[model samples]
Target: MQNKIESLYKETLKIRLFEENLIKLFSDGKITGTTHTCIGQESNAVGIASLLKKDDCILSNHRCHGHFLAHTNQYVGLLKEILGEEDGVCSGIGGSQHLFYQKIFYSNGILGGNMPMATGLSFANKMKKNNKLVCLFIGDGSFGEGNIYESLNFISVFKLPILIVVEDNGIAQTTETKNTIANKIEKITASFKIETSILNYPDAYDIYTKSKKIINKARKGYAQIIVIKSARIGPHSKGDDTRSIKQLNLIKKKDPLIKIKKKIKSKEKIKKINLDVINEINKIFNFKSQSYSNRKVSLQNKKNLILIDNPLKTFDGKRFGELINHFFHIIAKKNKKILFFGEDIVDPYGGAFKITKNLKNLYKNQVFSTPISESTIVGMSSGLAIEGYRPIVEIMFGDFLSLAFDQILNNLSKFYYMYNQSITLPLIIRTPMGGGRGYGPTHSQSLEKFFYGMHGINIYSLNPFFPLEKIYEEAFQNINPNLIIENKIQYNFILDDLNNSKYKSLNTKNDIKNFITNMSLSNYEDDCRTIICHGGASSAVINFAYDDFIETENSSRIIILSKLNTLNIEEIKKNISDKGPIIITEESYKSFGLGSEIITTLIEDEKFKGRNYMRISSKEGVIPSSKSKEEDFLLSAKTINKKVYNND
Candidate 1:
């Protein structure tokens, strides 16, 4: 007991001193971003962390310095991270607010965001039967967030191995918790039938004893909560302390470090430990290390063309929707690690679009119908992916993706880079996009443009001409996360050889005809203009104006591109004629959309400087519910024809 007390005091002292030094550094303008200090609340983190096994997972909130120190114990790495040094933990991408160590530790700046991710990690633990528990550290402020409630319900329903640690410091940044929160933490969590434990300003030994019981229960596939009534000694962040001197003095009196030191009662030993810790920290800061450089992380070691020669066998005359259903069925059957998560995607409903019909019937354990929480759906998939499971999540409509932007942009897209390429998030988020079905403005939107430039994520569009089986195979095998954008209009289209044929024109003398003939005969055309189109817009352009444009424009040819990001610029340039005009078209709005990106790419090419460039896209406006108005809002055959013939 004496030894444990000494160890706890040492850990607490380490965190307190580290944060104290950081506070001084920030005051002197040494540290850049704002820092959240857990000086008085060290007992909560150090206590619970003591019970965690090496493989157990921890998801922390903004005030995560104590958690990072307690969990990882990498003094130099944590100090360097707070200092924003490149060699720091997370390679300096994650400042004090965002710190990730290996697969077990993760912290984020968003309140209540880590709750769902922690629940997900618990789900993965349960799925893999790893006998590991996931601990989530959230603030009192998170009690007011809907995400925490959603995560709690999900964890309870699934009986995941997770322990939620609510560090109630009585203050949520500037606002006191009593002013913002209505109910007590214990009472609120009890409503969910979750087992709860409350500790009031316990010392390190008290915390360790209480948390070990809860965590042991959690490891047996039970969901639990431990509320630690702690105090914040310093300001919420740098330069933000609003507490009065009296309140500050009261908090300092209850400091865990002081209490533990009193119990140890050895001044010489304590002084010696403090000196050693201080010297170690100083050495890490003074060590002359090489400056940091941003390195590009790649999913593929070598650039290899995606070959589609061996396609999954599909029944004759399958529609696009049926083909999608077939693809999921085959892939899920072949790979047991693939799990499907979405709203209303099980059994009879089979998803909002009926694309996932019959999946749950075959793979009942692997497939699950989620609630309407888009954030948890995506956030949990990130956790599952990190745990070595290929989670294919469906978002129903692409417009709803805005709800999950934080998880997709800040969490999913950055996990690989932030972790210095130590982990891979092999997650596939498949959602139906485009605007032809009259589902109104909110329901029907081609929002792929918003995610165009995100690194570490691949965006794919389903083309009627291509085999769905091959796309699914590639998506399942991809090392990084992929967003498969399926057009609602193309769901019912019949699969045929006509859709797969190369560009053809009724006019025999058209340049597209010459280009196709030359390519077929192993000849090349140097002056052939190229037209690029993707998604439903490609079908619209091909059906309404292909023959007429071919008859009129003798210097232009057309090709369909499905993959949007990580574009094969070299391959596209190989087909284009030298200095020829390049025309790009899309169904999305023109502002900062795919068409704009393509134009920018061409403009940046030194060899394509003299080339004529044009983009045919929808005007910046809402898609009307009426079919005629929607057509007018989108780029159509008439629009393309006018742009080609009249140069409008």
Candidate 2:
């Protein structure tokens, strides 16, 4: 242990020197983009990193050089990544501000934001029974984020196996932490009911010593917090000239390296340590730098058939039991990469909806049953995606996703852009949405629009039908966060009979019973003029239009925008180009919703020539619970048709 400490001291000095050199390079304009350097606080990183196990995960803040190098030997790869080299972790997309190493699973940059993610990872470990600990390293400044408190509160309540390391450097950049943060570190953490340990991070030996014990306790299912008090000698980043040259020079005189080396007496020992460090640095630099410069991302084949099968195809319930059996079999066969988590979301019980019934039986380790924690359900999905798994997590009901919104919006949504596209959050959040069976407003409402408008997210929000095969295929192959909203109303909807025993209900027949017949057919007549519709409401509108409304040749056409974001602009242009009348309809409210966005898009589109378009949408208020009220104000076939034919 002494030898290890001594060697780590040498490594700490190496990190200091490396950072100093990188600062010089940044000043000389060799390194592009801003960087947060970890020069003054070396021991905290080296000490804590040494205590971490191989499979354990670490989440770092913007000042991450020390933390990153401490955890993994991917030094050259990291530097190249910071340098924006093509061979870097994210192939030059994530510059120094966004560096990731899958082996160590470390993330650099993005403020104190990784805490919730780390908390979630611990939740996953517990559910998987993997006995892995997670370490979250954040600066004193990060304690100000609301998510940190939320994360701490959750870890305490759940007793999640995680280690929280707060690097209490005297300053958070130019502003001292005391000004911004209200409570003492220990006091703040203790208020959340978390076990806390404060340490003076004066040297690498001290950090390694305390971190080992804390990490051990966490690995054994105990949660802990290690407050490391240190000082920053370097500027917030390489570019900050906040400290004059004279002041910087004076601070450099008290560098951590000088402090550590002062304790070593023998010149021979110093020389040996110096020589070993130089050799190691050179080896790491040469190998990693070159490899990262030539690295390429291994992406799934563009034409892979793994995504071609649809799980919803089984919803066509001819023989409900057989259809359910075939649904599980198809998901198991097609998306071999899909991972699931929920209570009894496995064989025999598949799920409350039998969606994952046979998945665990076939996939074994892939599909899993998790503890009853919605936060972990979302959090683990984020971590699993970070580790390169195409995880499709089910949150029992749409209402439960609210429990994991921190992991969803803060950690998952912001990862890509904050890291400059360094990480591809290839994940799918599947949940049943909509109200018809009295699940109340919470379980029934479509919440996809909330995520649809979030920044740093290009998620696909889909509620598919009939062409389930095509939708499923596209969803899996597309490398982005996909939110598939399964209409609970269709769970028992019947399909034609197929002769196959496993999939007798899998007959491929498109029925108008619950479908929108295209009104765009040439020579079709319009008695009711124009009808605007979407999803289930549209299905009802189509039948009403054909039955009651008169059909005139060369009349109005229909616009089918399945994905709300990619609202078929071409179709909108075509509809409004002839100055033809239109009716814009949607289930959401008129306030900044799908209908609003569509209206704005149309007004901005040059093809729209002052056309008279009536917007038939829910009133700008809270959604009414009663079916009578919903039918009266909110969008429905009856309301939509009545409004469209009011003056016709």
Q: Using TM-score as the measure, which candidate wins?
A: 1
For model 2, the local distance difference test gives: 0.64
Which runs in model 1 stand beyond 4 Å of their true positions? Answer: 262-312, 469-479, 497-529, 549-556, 577-581
lDDT of each: 0.77, 0.64
Candidate 1: residue pairs that collide? none
Quick one: best lDDT, which candidate? 1
Q: Mind giving the per-residue lDDT tens digits that candidate 2 earns over 1-648?
A: 547656777989778767776777687887888888888787778878777887787878888778878887567766777677766666676666556665355564656556656765776687667888888888898887766776676677768898888888757777778999998999999898777899864577666665666778888778999998776787788755476778667766655566666667677888888888887766655554354342344544432345444444445445333454465467656665567767568778888778777777778867877666666556656666654556777888776777767667766766655443444666777776555555555665666566656664443333223454454455555555666656565555544422333122112223222222244433333323455555544444444444343342333445434444344555545433243566666555555666666667777866554757777765555545677665555555566656666842
Candidate 2 positional error at 312, Å: 8.1
- Tell me the lDDT of model 2 at 319: 36
Q: TM-score of every model?
A: 0.88, 0.72
Counting clashing residue pairs in each candidate, in order, gives 0, 13
